[model samples]
Target chain A: MTLNNFIRIFITIIFANYINSKINFFITDYYLNFTLGFLVFSYWVFTLEEHLYALPSFCIGLSIDLLSGSPFGLNALLFSISSYIIHSYRYSFKIFSFLQVTIFFAFLSMFYLGFIHIFMNTANFSYLLIFLSFFLNGIAWIFIYILMNRFKKIFYK
Target chain B: MARIAPGNTPKLGYFVLIILASLFLYLDIQYKTFTSTKNFFNAGLIATNLAINNIVFSPISNLYKLTNNKLALINSNELLVEELELSKSENFLILNKDKLFNDNSELYKFINNISNDYPHEIATISSFDTNLYKCCDNHRLHLFNNSSPFKKGGTVINSTGIIGQISDSNNKVSEVILISDINHSIPIKSNAFFCNASGSGRPKVLECKYDPSLWKESFEIGRIFYSSGLGGIFPEGIMIGSIISIENVEDGDILLNIKSIANPLTQKNVIVLYPNDIK
Candidate 1:
């Protein structure tokens, strides 16, 4: 990646951190729209290469752990596993279209959130939350992917 | 973008890390290592939040000052005039009485009477965990600290009503076991009945287990409950909550559903009670 691309990614990561701090997941409330936003961010991290993305995911998880006052390293483990899954599968899948990527990410995001529900021993894992999270993440990913594509078109050319 | 193949060895390492972190978290929960870590984390978080709050509020505050300058000045002048009138009245009361010295003695006596009611000093809640479970446990520790003048099991409160009893205390912060914890049992009473109200781990709710024979009439919704002061943890007549509902079962047991009058979630300030004789 060029220096400018690297800087753009760094800025995006900072923006995500700020957003995470401002938004409450409402893990307390049974269902909320904020969880969907979290899933979208998680999916974006998942699509990236492991070596390049693992460090950012780790930082994101650490920031969350600090901000949420959860037991240290809880998010670290969850995000690490999610990114690892995406990295492992990234090569086999063809990058046919934005829709395909969105569907793939939605599946992974659901699995990520499902794993958290089981780990936390919540009363019920709202399928609505899971499905809505995927849909929202898909919507967010379109904007991000479009921006990345545009950047690639103008600068990479 | 170039992608690298993941080796089996690194994946195994990640799995091991997950297992190890999970074990640490579980052990921390069971053994309470998280308590100290939570305190340290809270201190940092409080500092950061304060800085953020200042930054965010500064602009709004400045704007308000600019727009409301005349209003604020008028209000301050009014307050000063009221203070002057009150002080002049107090001075007249002092000078007009032949036995003004007795009034000083009476004032001293009043202060002495209230001084013993609260021996331990009040502490501010500087920071709290965003996660409810973590917040609950941290609050429990803050009330329970040994150093607090509150008896091993004495009640804590704010200006409004009872919060929880002193479960533990330390030099800096005391652990407060909230009324919502499963382990808490407070002896409470109403005008017509007395019972032990137990916590069910739900916020703002308590279950009062009363003897069926004690009640001449069935407990109804909206019946107010008060601290019986039988357990010596709380002072008598403090408002607990009104009875939200009641159920009597076939086994002759009675359950009174109570909601606390004071919402602990929104309480930014609290007072710790120390028995009169502690000094």
Candidate 2:
């Protein structure tokens, strides 16, 4: 990676950690842990054409697992699988509609939250949050995509 | 132009990484091996937070404290004034301690009989049915103590004189049958004339029917009466009350209505003297 790309990743990790901490502290009290940090890292890695996804994805998931107080490699395992699937389907997404992409993002978010809910909070986990977060993450993807595009334009301009 | 994506994902590589990650997770959860790692990371995060709090939040808070010095001083002054008033009241209690007890010469002897170290307590009436006290024969009262337990058969007195005895006691509350309860009677002394005065079912009223021919002096109104302590229930020579009326009828019985000095309505807080055997 170039110096510029390294700086971007460093800042994005710090910013994602800050947002994840805030969401867990304030917003995720009774809801699902939105996995904002892992999602941000996944979005950045998947959009880039470098084909070097697994290493960066593992690092991001491990950082989130440490910050989130989950089992050490729980997020790493799940995030790695999701990133691989998205990378393989990236060419297919070129012809996909916006609703189809949103549905795909919703499905991925639901599976992620539901899987963790089964292991981490089995006693009181609500499947309702998994379904609700499916919609929320679908909407959030649009914002994340626009913001990344804006950053790319500013950085490359 | 957008670059072409990778035609396929590396399934074998992904499988290998998943297996490795799953093994790490299994070791973490099953053996808690990562607790120390998590604790170390937590300690680092906490140290970072404390540093930021010191560098960012502390100066702002110090500035606030500096600006609020006048408010703190004002609060301190108010607290000091309240404390001074409480101390003044306590000082008044210390000065007038003797006057709170009655003017009986046998007071010290009576207290010594109860206990050499004086182990009695002061209690107030928590509940007294005034309507029933005036009209009913029971005249029971509930007493509460912040000091010690008021035992059953303990003597109850006020600043003026002996009023009654406690009929029941527990950790929380005690019941007292006042001197005016119809079932109650106190042995009294009046110039070698002794009789048991029974309650008249009225506040501060007790009636004693005696043979007028026994004592040389005729029954006189306003004559002083005192507890003789003959029954071992009450302390002797406590000024109980003065005679209010003497009526002689055809039955040859002298009916006397002696008024009590300690009115339960007037003097609310009474002293309880617990006997040594019941202590």
Candidate 3:
């Protein structure tokens, strides 16, 4: 038996968030953050059926919000908005080159980081961290994209 | 036949979800409508973590220690640490005995009746996210106090000095708002000036903003600051920190950055000084 679409997306995003939080434990001291969960959500939106994604994405983000210390619904709002945007642009992404897509993801991740910092931690916000992580996330998103595509092959098969 | 791309998907549901989420976020942040929910969730999470540690990890570690013959050494070390903590707390009580009782005759009598035994509870750190502590303004710690419950606004101190105060408490654990959290502030004074030093959101740092025109006193680096007892939460004359740097802001205000003397991360156990005990 195979997992349905909702379960697949839910498990994948949860795993991404868990790994992202664990990775942050070691790197946040150095002023770095990786938005692996957001990346995975965007990828799933691009690949899967899109019309029903907004609700599932919202629900999944609500689950994550419950476990996190951030204000309730912050992640849900962001995930819903991101799902909408990525879904709207999925057709365009099909024709874009790999480098352009990577660049787009890097900038999107930066926006996510910046927005969260503004609402959740305005006092400790650092442009230096956001600036540095842009490059770091750019590199990280490439690895995540490739690795996720490999898993996608197994799931689709 | 081919499936339609997600780009062509309907947009109405997404719009509705976004609006719903935004409403929830606003309500939660503005009115703290979900604070009780968050607290309940936190209490449950801490309980689960403690249960896992006690039921699974503790016995596994004990078995490993029994097989390795290191249990005795570990137990001795733990005993020594406990003794050291107790001694440190005793020293604090002795040092502040006079000041803590000067105003409260009833409390003083109660302390005298107790003899040398001080009234304070030792709480162990339950959960702390160093990542948020280092990177954000919310420097909170979950502390487990199995004894009597910790009262909110009670002062929490380690071996060094004041680390924070109890902000919230439930059945399972108490939440500590560290001095370095942006939302926390302590009324502090030096030789010349008095101001409320707010948390800088940086580890072990607090910032005091004052107008240069109103406060003519000059501040220099390394100048010591002490609690002013204005808020009545913390004891007066206790060492808070020292001025580390000064900067002039856009509105002709002077911002003095203080490096706090107490480091919460240095110890696993903290002593909670209830106001009723001291006042």
| Top candidate when judged by DockQ against the true structure | 3
Residue-wise C-alpha lDDT for candidate 2, range A1-157, written one tens digit per residue: 6657755764675586567555654444345456566566656665776654676567667776786666789888888878887887788788888778767776787787787766665534576767777877777777777887788677732
Please state the Cα-based DockQ of model 2 relative to the true two-chain complex. Answer: 0.15
Judged by DockQ cut-offs, the docking class of candidate 2 is incorrect
Clash pairs for candidate 3: none
* Candidate 3 structure quality by residue, lDDT tens digits, B173-244: 889999999999999988658999999988899999999899999989998888887866776667788889
For model 2, what is the error of residue A143's alpha carbon versus the real structure, in angstroms, after optimal superposition?
Answer: 1.4
The C-alpha TM-scores of every prediction are 0.64, 0.47, 0.86
Instruction: For residues A1-157, write the lDDT of model 1, one tens digit per residue.
Output: 4556545554555565456434532433444323343453454554444343555556566556555555566666677676676666565455446577677666665676665554442433466766676666567566666765575466542
lDDT tens string, model 2, B1-279? 234477767677778888888887999979978866764665466557667889999777757866987656755786786565434333322333354234544555554454552346667666565534542355667676456557778887765566788876555566788898877999988777898988876668888888767756676789888787777777667677889988886668788999987677755566777556666
Point out the worst 10-residue segment of candidate 1 chain B by lDDT. Answer: B92-101
> TM-score of A-chain in each prediction?
0.63, 0.84, 0.90
- Comparing only chain B with the true structure, the TM-scores of all models are 0.62, 0.59, 0.85
lDDT of 1 by residue, B207-257 (tens): 877566766656678977777768555655566788887787666877787
lDDT of 1 at A106: 62
Candidate 1 residues lying further than 4 Å off, grouped into runs, are A1-30, A36-41, A50-63, A92-157, B1-9, B48-114, B120-123, B128-156, B165-177, B181-185, B191-196, B209-217, B246-255, B265-267, B276-279
Arranged by DockQ, best first: 3, 1, 2
